[model samples]
Target: MPATCQVRVLGGFGVTVDGSPVPAHAWRSRRAADVVKLLAIETGHRLHREQVMELLWPDLPVEAAGANLRKAVHYARRALGGPGAIAVDGQVLALWPDGCLDCDLERFNRDADTALASGDARACAAAAARYGGDLLPDDRYEWWAEEPRARARSRYVALLRAAGDWTRLLELDETDEEAHRAMMRRHLAAGRRREALRQFERLREALRERVGVGPDAETVALYETALAEGAEPPSVEQTVAVTLANGLVAWGRRNVEEAERLAKRARALALDAGLGHELGEASTLLALVAYARGTWHEQFRQEFADSVRRSANLENAVFDAHLCFQEFYLYGPEGHEGAESFGRDLLGIATAADSTAGRALAHLLLGEFALLSGHLDEARAHLDLSLTDAERAGCLSAQSIALERAAETQVRRGDRRAAAALLDRAMPLAHSSGIRSHLVIRIHGLRVLAAGGLVEALGAVRDGERLLAEATHVCDPCSMAFRIEAARACVRANDLGRARRHLAEAERISGLWQGGPWSAALWEIRAELRRATGQTTQAAALFLEAAELYSTLHRPLEEDRCRGAAGVR
Candidate 1:
């Protein structure tokens, strides 16, 4: 029978053989470490031998791979105290049944996920305590291992901070003896003698049993004096911070309406507390939300500038810069200069700060500008940089936008097939993350489909109508613009009947927006629809109007196309 093994690494790195400490050398070789790490990550699940072989020797030929794999297993067994400690049969291996070890990284992952999923503060704290160091710090230099290690480190940090936040909430654990001790001290200061004395004894007894320690000299001294203090504790200045955190979560979840309200409250509280960082963050978030909702560029720019000035903190400054770019992009077609300036500022700030999130957002904004300006290489560079950063950071929302920008660049480069593949890859990430930019991605998806002529006329029309309906529901100008581009793509596919339906929706949105470059493009599509249906006179007049609008917007290529439609080019 195999000896039982207990592997433990949750609080610290150690293993127990039949409830006894096993020396670290018992697990030998980089291959052994790799196997243990991978299996431990999956907990009780079994990894097929082929899978392990492929992971460990991704470049090896099959014949040599099997021989090396066997040698690795042999070495692992010898290092682990012999055949009984590590058993292998065919493609399956199992640790000794009585084997046990401590794994801090594993514990951190399990408990941290629990805390995040359930908002369990206690679990988060436990996970934080377990996360003593990075995953196999001894292996940090291994390039292939850095991604998983970094991910584990980030999760632990986020969970620990969240737990600390909840610990301060009072709602999570009001009966916390620490809170009682705090309450007792406050009561003593407020002249509530009996109440102070009672609270002090309660805390002292609780601490003696739980912590094996009595009240400190200061607390004891307060209890000795009676009628000195006991009133409701001073306003803790906690609400604003809590609300701001909640607002951030809400925004991440794409609940923009709630985020706006919570952020406003946070801002009000920050003002009262004179916390410039919180004030700036809340205000900048509000401005971004405003931009997302199609608020004017001048208004968002003013607010963004004010927030940056208020905080002057790196993160908040980055937020302000990103919001400024987004605002310029969404409003005033002629305001490309603002977008360009903000993108430049963001890049400089991101480089100086060296924050991955900041750099990714800056790249995303710049990529958008590059696409609009028809700089294909520049667009690809920025979009790829953004996507790489976002993917590394596990920021799915940012990654989705980066892919969307890349897809647009691909389309401009006349690589329609590549654009479709890019959209397909990005859509699931956007949807699963519940990102607010799902609307943006979906609109782009429609463009890809229309450009590829993947669906016949009726089917394409139905899909376009459905997407436009959703885009209109969001009432976001950026989303509406993309949807209009999708409509133009459908017209190019020679789906004129379907194009007219999309054109009507575009016309309605244009009327609401008072017309822009997007609206002018939609008019060109409308002319195409009219011509396809043999309404030549009406098409000619509409084409001339579209040319005029495109010329006013300085889109010469688009204006030329519209003029050619009117037979004047």
Candidate 2:
């Protein structure tokens, strides 16, 4: 009995006969495999000899290439164990129909196209899986293989995406920006905002690194929509919580005016509804705005405390969790032990409730606390977990914040390359969500720290200063940090006038926040400026003050650095 001919071309080019492998040496001529692949993939498994000859040996004369084609055909037939396997007419070559020629590429195309046309997602998914890799991956650079391979891969990706098999599509083509965008949209639709935002970042990096281009306008617009306030209030009574959450989202994106307006509206709605939880949430948001606007430290502190008490008394778990998270932001660095306790409580509540956003925020608080305490490895682990939770929950705002903190951790670990890579991945998502100001300023400050030259560092400081001046909430903690960093950068550049101005501004902001983390940074920069200007005694005093603040914050590494700077043990 004649052998059955089987061809596999999806992952690689291969031929078998009667369920037996064709020995590698049997088709020693490179063109033999090429001939078999071409014949199998061609319409009706047939192609004109001249066409095959042209594709396989365009460098040779027509007659010489024809001779080579004949030799290749003979080898192919022998490899298939019979001349009848590949029959040649006067001008055409074909896999003999009677030979029971079966090809995976042909079957994949037929099933995928049919399933797509029928809108059968399950069938399409099954067909798409058959495409294990690019068509004839080994022949990737061959001109003859390009068109069909691309067509197969594109169809496979489209089918997988349509079937909601994002993982498989990504596995097939990691550099496919469209696939990434589709998956991002899917994640967002499923309420996984952090995952969506992370996908956008991955797409941005892949496009930039692989193709030297950014995402198209469509992708950016979609991300912007994802970042926008999307809650729909089902009734007037429910408007307060929806509006409050929207206000929080706006604030996260640094839209101060919009946040304030939404927060005020939410408060009004809460009062009308007589909902204690709504009122508490609204109050918390308003307090955050006040703190960000550089309100007096005592006033902000009292307001936050009042909000927390009200939220706790409401006996609302969600509202209480929100209040606890806010408290951590307000005093977490200065009171690490308290922050840890609150974080653990929030984590427990969120886990029990299966609230992805709450868990993400809890992890972020813990991560930031760990990072501040100089526990680098622990901080990294916490940040990673925070990012994971945020992604799974589809919280873009939390994802962006976690990514920034992760980059900061990398910077502290003295990995400029890793830090830059992280920032590069983060900036696009931040921009998409309209939260780029603070992150951009931080990036500029990081550049100052990492720059090799005084000139470069000074330039970065100027950029950071410009961003701070343009920010909607210039008194935010990050803005204050930017000012201190700018002052230090200017001091290093010997630009005394700008350094003094930035230092004075930082001091003014620090005065509003009192003994917060920014105060330590402000004093450290002041000490540096004083030391540079020959004010040794004042510098020593400022350094000691900074050291004490760091000690209070439980940042022993920073405290020791300050003590050393002050000429103490």
Candidate 3:
């Protein structure tokens, strides 16, 4: 019988066989033990022969590396008690992952993912506890180890955030400003006014001690708020801010009526206060509420412009520019042409301000523009920049959004495998700490891939669909868009009944934009179903109608495709 192997690679590297530690002298060489380590980190305890050789002995000649690889495997096998423990399959090396192996890396990943997907505090705590430390601290300099180590650290931090284990986070990274800020927020929220101040002091001391810098502007703002301590009446700006904050929270909950009511009140208060800045923010909020309601008033664009004009007197113009861009992007049907200008404006302001977070947003918008305009190369460049900036700034939200856009670009470029891999990378990030909208986008991509015939994505679609069902109130148009994709996917799978159901659901909410892109999509998909069901004439007519709609929307590629589709038998 084979001796069971227990592998531990989080924080440190160690192995035991049959409940006893494998001594250093057991392996023929360190390189041999590394062969096992390499395989242990992988998803299925496997790596291609070339991959193993390149990683382990990148400086050596291939022939030499191959010989050394064989030698390492031979020695590692003997140390681990041979055949049942490891083997080479054709061009790949694999560790036996049956009853013979128990890997902490796998267990930690599984538990962490479970917690992330659920967002349950208890689950987060459990997962955080399971994370002994960073993955393979000894191999910190290794390129392959770096990614897994960073991923593990990110997930651990996310878990700590969810569990409110600030001490643990600080223990792992004393210079983590986010952890410190989160602690401050917790203190403030709990009415621990003095503690909040003390927390801020701790952050100030830590930053100065560790990096010789002061707290950021945002952190200082929080500190000032804590310092106020009801010493004076709330200013008009503060009062307006509270109202707008409530309205925004209402909007997030999909309570459109309540949000609209609160927005109106906020606008009144701002007007009474005679503050142009707050007025601009209030107007922007109202426009957002209207957009969420899927019924933009006639002056929507004017409202956004007026808001920006109102905010121009302020030193920080990024806020108003972002508000305008955000609202215009929502009205995709009529305001599509204007989105680029606002995006450019945002990018310019962000660039001038030297704001990494702003540049990340700007690049994200530009990337979307390029992707939608059918410029794959431009899209990739913009999205790549967005990811780089987002990562550099430590903005996980921006990172997740950029990944989503990049994955979509990959899908459009006909690289389903790359799209799937990108989404795989995004899933954990989104699940851990991302907003509901972010998760929806990630899930939407997964389901789209599944519909595009990526079989592996099929397994993940159910969870995605479940989350979508709960998030219908987030963005009505988004709901219809996802359903359109799902319907098309179902049709591709030849599941006509399911497709029709999805189409009906989408069309139910599409009454607001009867001739928009989504309406055009419904026409094209209906044509597909008709053609699938042997109604050729009906299908062609629908195709022509969709082509006409696409032409009206300035979608030349989609128009051309639909036109060609109309003539396809």
Candidate 4:
């Protein structure tokens, strides 16, 4: 059998044969090693004799170079264990086609190319891990190796950037100016302004220490942007407005306690400043928090009404859009037509303002509404548009939301496999963008539903429940829906205790915030739990109620399911 040979050029140069390192003396002839390196990296592992001579023995006379090439080939063959390892034709030299040769550089390039083509970030990261350093680091000053070294370095850097492995990229080369800029951009995009500023400072210091110069114009501009964004509030009213906006963001992420605190602060500030508009926004945010907490406080309802009245009297298009969104939450399930109309109005306003984020939000809401109404095609169309806008704007949070909702549409359309794939794609975006726990919880719940077998589904539900418990403030409608599904899974697995607990939680939430389209699901799960516990009369009544609710909601499939469960004609 041919001797197995392995060549490694990244970080340094080394060769092994038959699982043992080649003897040091085997590479004593530097020219022979160079010849082998060139052939191994070259396309098809073949190069003409003249090219090799020109590269290695460039300054020698043609006859002398020819003789040197012949001697180097002889040494390379011996080092590789025999003549069969190196093939020499009349004017060309190459590695033997059938020989046992494993080259790290070849493998790295192949892996990188495949990953880049597929746009698989994890695969790209794995490929990038193979790049220990520049090609043949020991051959730093070799003129013949300069171009290939630069090429390899550039490819590796590109792979790291594509994978969003910012920390790893910095570890590989802290002095890389582009990597610094990329990191700053990523942090800023994820709303980590302070981190972006800190990264810029680190880059500036590194550049000044290593090269005695500050960052370039673009890097400096990016730092300035971060600084401007992080600037202190100019006025009390403006500060309160900012606080209210931040609270809204926290609420979206299901951090209800944090949102409540921030909203209270904003309301106090606005009350002191007597800024009606700011106070209105603050009140609206507080109401949103109350809703997320499943409390449905009387104060929340009064505040929501006051905010809507105040916003309607104002000329702020953005505030109007927000108010419209609040209305959707307030009456969406009970008034689908009105909710859809509000969605269209928001879309129009967003488009008029040329706001990608606004447009994406409108599309997401519309898509969700359509999905709830059983308009699968319309849901998909809206979701696709939202995804396009979100991606174009580099809105990672929006992209994750769009993808998660699209996955639900697929699941409802009976394509669990496609839904699973969509969730898989959404997960990285969710992590990178810091998506709210409500969305993440729903994503996990969908994954549980998609998983085959009672055991696997129960395992997923348990894991998701653990995560949900960690986010204690999460009490949104999505959370209620997830609880209902978890209860269903528990029933499927014959875990009556757990199923009852989940069903009770769902019932409590639905009772506090009644009349939503999801109330039907809550009722259906309660019926299932009752049926499992031998409460036949109560189960039948609950099933009939669920069927009535589904029928009112115009959800034919769910209505039929509930009717079947209730044994109705």
Candidate 5:
């Protein structure tokens, strides 16, 4: 009822009824609550007076029913705390959007519609999460209340799942027996079997205590089967969903098999689904898995070709464009003309489609390429655009990733303090969103820490190792990245044996990954390690190889590093 009223319908129908919070003493009648609920759920705050009278007094004669409806409206206004809350305009009864009644349902509905139109999961999740619980739980028996209830429930289920907020969903609706069962299936789909069973048990106990009933048959059976199986790995589809999330968990651990398995499964699923946004998710995840393992070139070519051939809808088309930008960043050259060209094409399409994720992605990629190519000022502009869009869209994972990349660029250009501050802001957001790419960023952050002398004497070394270990556990590990940092950390610690081992591993992975900005750095790092370990001949050979690769790739900074490491500076 106040200006820009706040209503949260998701948890329950909570409303600021006419510029005031409905005090406990005010909600004395179910009919009064029902009246407000009815009008709030109507389209455009408009409802017919005759229809309301019929609903409130079905069997009364017309004259008596009219009297009853008027009385009900009067009392409802009083309960809402003012006469200004509701007014009759001839044959119509309406709640003013700005005055005595603001409904969360209306806000949720509006946000959900916008998100659905845009096909952005984060926006959808934010909108859907506003629906706290059953609408008008205090007046659930009213027949007219079912429509808003159903709409809220459906949106919650769809958006929560899409946003991968399984734990939150379970928490919000543990006693909703149907939702509990559905959550089990979702957890299983996401490859979280333990969590699935735990949720089911919680629901079962809650149902038992609250209503003297066990879990629904479907929920019980799912629990039984999953328990009997004793924690098998997730299904291919579920595994793919998790792995597409970026990097493996834990310190210096990678789940290469799982990442590969999930990507493969996603591909199969995509093929079966065909021509839709879901299929595009699969395609993009596969590309990400490829990029994570440093084998993106061939996969990128294949996916780009496939995307160009497809005539999908706006959502799917935009997703495909996002994939191209990611590919260009990971596999294309530094200050990559190719990436920039592809990015322009993709960004244009995303703009036309009004795809928030696509636009954020394009900006992030373009910024990263620009930064690597010595265009730091341009990088800052693009990265800011990326962060702004990501924040507005509520895509925390995308936002964190962009921030981390931007922080790296900042650190490289004598802005160490700013870079650290960015990392601090980004870490929690990244962890909450389950974004594995943060591992790579954190490792880079450690370099800034060492350079800034902010870390303990051996802190950076230990932290670097831990991050590398986690990266390995998730997929085909970023073995080269792990090695480059591990080698540097070890050298700093004066551990020559470990340093050589790490350098050797870096060399192996670099050879496997072939030419790229990162791989070239790996080679140069290996050369430095070799030179430090008194393997002068080997160091010269590795440095020469690295320089040749860097020159071919037009990366003078890296070529210079290789020459310096070879003692030819």
Candidate 6:
């Protein structure tokens, strides 16, 4: 029988065999102990011999490292008690092969994954409590441990924030300004002005001691208001901000009419107040309403052009960046004249303004610009930058958008597995941005479907269609994209009935807007649909038509792909 192994690495590192601590003197060498430690921290407590040698003895020659790994494995087995304690099959090594291991990091990950997937507050609190501290604090300098340590620490902090455990968070990191601000806001929101003031002072002390800087402008503004004491009438900026925020909430909840009303009100208030920043925000909100209603090109320019120009002249980087994103997002960039230059100009503005959010969205625009121009590598680089900037900016919607675009690039490059992983991470963030609506969620469902087993594709098809039926937006372009992908997926699954229906809806939507990617997409999918139905000559013609449209869009990769399919036909 295999011995039960208990490994703890959250706060520190230790191992127990059958509930008894392994005596320190029992270990033959420090490297032997380190070998056990490394394996215990890795996924499923397993690593191939080559990888283990690379991580543990990268400087040594291959033969010498392999010899050392053998000795280490032998010592590790003796230290843990019994050959079954550590298993080696050929070149693969794993700790506790009998599934008798009790690992704190594993427990914490399970709890954290559950909490994140469910979005339950109580679950988050439980996961936060389960985190004993940083992972393997004693091994902080180990290169191999750094990634897992940082990942665990990040998850713990996110859980703490979600659970509203600010006090505990402050105990963990004294200079956490965001945590302090959250405490201050809670106190002020509850009419406890004195408490809010005290919180701000605590934050100021922490900042001065740790970073040697004063509070930032936003915090300072809040502090001044705290000094005056809570519960005053909402000011002009406050009113506009509130209105726009509520509009966002309404949009997320699919109450488009209410969102439109709030957007209009916010715009009117900002215009009357003559606040450039608020006016910029207000104009974007109106633009968002127009987008939700699928009249962006027709309604947006006429209704919001002067306000947008005014905001840009006022140097509102966020406003300028968002307006650029809207155009690129709707039209797919390169097909529209001057779109690439517009994105470059916005990127320059965002950089000069030092606005992380502006930079994030600007990069997203350029990434899409690159993507539509068939520059998959360039698109991926831009999207990666966007994701990093978005995370630093602490904006969920921006992060989600960046992740989705990155996933799209992966799918285009025929890496559906990578696409699936990204979409999984993007789902929760997209929820708060109203993009988790069926309209957007189902758009990439086919990629995820492709990631599943080919034999199981039909099951995924049903699931994807269920999501498709829940569409909650009037955006024709979005619907067209979703249906085309759905049609493609269905054709692969040999479900031509569903394929034809999806293609029909997609065709109807494409007819609304003249020749573009949608038309190209429909032609490509219809070719496949025709092929599935044994119409070989007609399918060849449709594929050629699709290739021509793809060429017009400068999508050389896609054009070549369609042309190849035509050749095959």
Q: What lDDT is obtained when candidate 6 is compared to the true structure?
A: 0.70
lDDT of 1 at 301: 43
Model 6, 1-569: lDDT tens digits are 34588999999878888788988788888778888888888888888989989887765679998999889888888888877777888888888898589999989998898898888878899888888887877665466787998899899989988888999888877778788888889998888887887786677545432333335556666766775554576567655655665665576677889978987897677666666555555555566667657776555334333333343322232333244336434455236445567567667757766666656766877887788777889999988998898787665666776787788888787787888788778877766542234224443554444465654455555555555533323345544555776677778877565577678878786676666677788889989978987899999999999999888877787798899999943
**What is candidate 4's lDDT per residue for 415-520, written digit by digit as tens?**
8889889889887776664224335666787777776567778888876776664343343555665687788998877666567668777777666555865688
Runs of candidate 3 with Cα error greater than 4 angstroms are: 1-284, 289-331, 432-434, 438-442, 450-461, 470-474
Give the distance in Å from residue 187's predicted Cα in candidate 5 to where it truly belongs: 15
The prediction achieving the highest lDDT against the true structure is: 4
In terms of lDDT, the poorest run of 10 residues in model 2 is: 312-321
Instruction: For residue 327, give model 3's deviation from the true position in Å.
Output: 7.9
Model 5 regions more than 4 Å off: 1-281, 284-329, 332-337, 437-450, 454-457, 467-472, 475-482, 535-541, 565-569
Tens digits of per-residue lDDT for model 3, 218-330 = 66677668767866766666566556656655766778888778778877776555665556556656766665666554334344333333332321222332333352363
lDDT of 5 by residue, 1-569 (tens): 34444455455666663355766557566556566667877876767888887776664568997887777778777766566677777788877544534567767777777877787878877877676676666544345665777777787777776666766765665566666777778778888878887776567445432332334435545766666566465554433333333222210135656645654565555555453433455455455557677776566545544443443332333343243345345544452546676666657756765766557766877886786566788988999998987787666656776787787777667787788778777777755642244244444434534356524424655555555433323212323444566566666555555566567665665564445765666666676667666788998988888887777776666677777767777
Question: How good is model 4 by TM-score?
Answer: 0.47
Cα lDDT, model 1, residue 221: 52
For candidate 4, give the lDDT of residue 449.
71
What lDDT score goes with residue 75 in model 4? Answer: 91
For each candidate, the alpha-carbon lDDT, in order, equals 0.59, 0.69, 0.69, 0.71, 0.60, 0.70
Tell me the spans in candidate 1 whose CA falls farther than 4 Å from its real position: 1-285, 288-331, 437-450, 454-475, 489-498
Please list the Cα RMSD from the true structure of every candidate, rounded to 1 decimal place.
18.8, 19.7, 14.9, 20.5, 24.8, 15.7
* Per-model TM-score versus the true fold: 0.46, 0.46, 0.48, 0.47, 0.46, 0.48
Error of 4 at 431 (Å): 3.4
- Candidate 2 vs candidate 4: the TM-score winner is 4
* lDDT digits (tens) for residues 1-569 of candidate 1: 32544454333345554555656676566677566555554455246677767766654568876777777767656655666554565676555534444445556677788878887878777666666665654543333455767787678657755676433422323334455556666665676666766675555434322232334545545544442233543232434534654565577678899989987787767765666545655665676577678774554444443433333233333343243346336335562445667776766765665657666767877887766655779979998998888776566667877887787777766787788788778777756642233234344544544365546433544454455433312334435555565566656666443455456666675564555676677777778777766799999999999889878765565688789889998
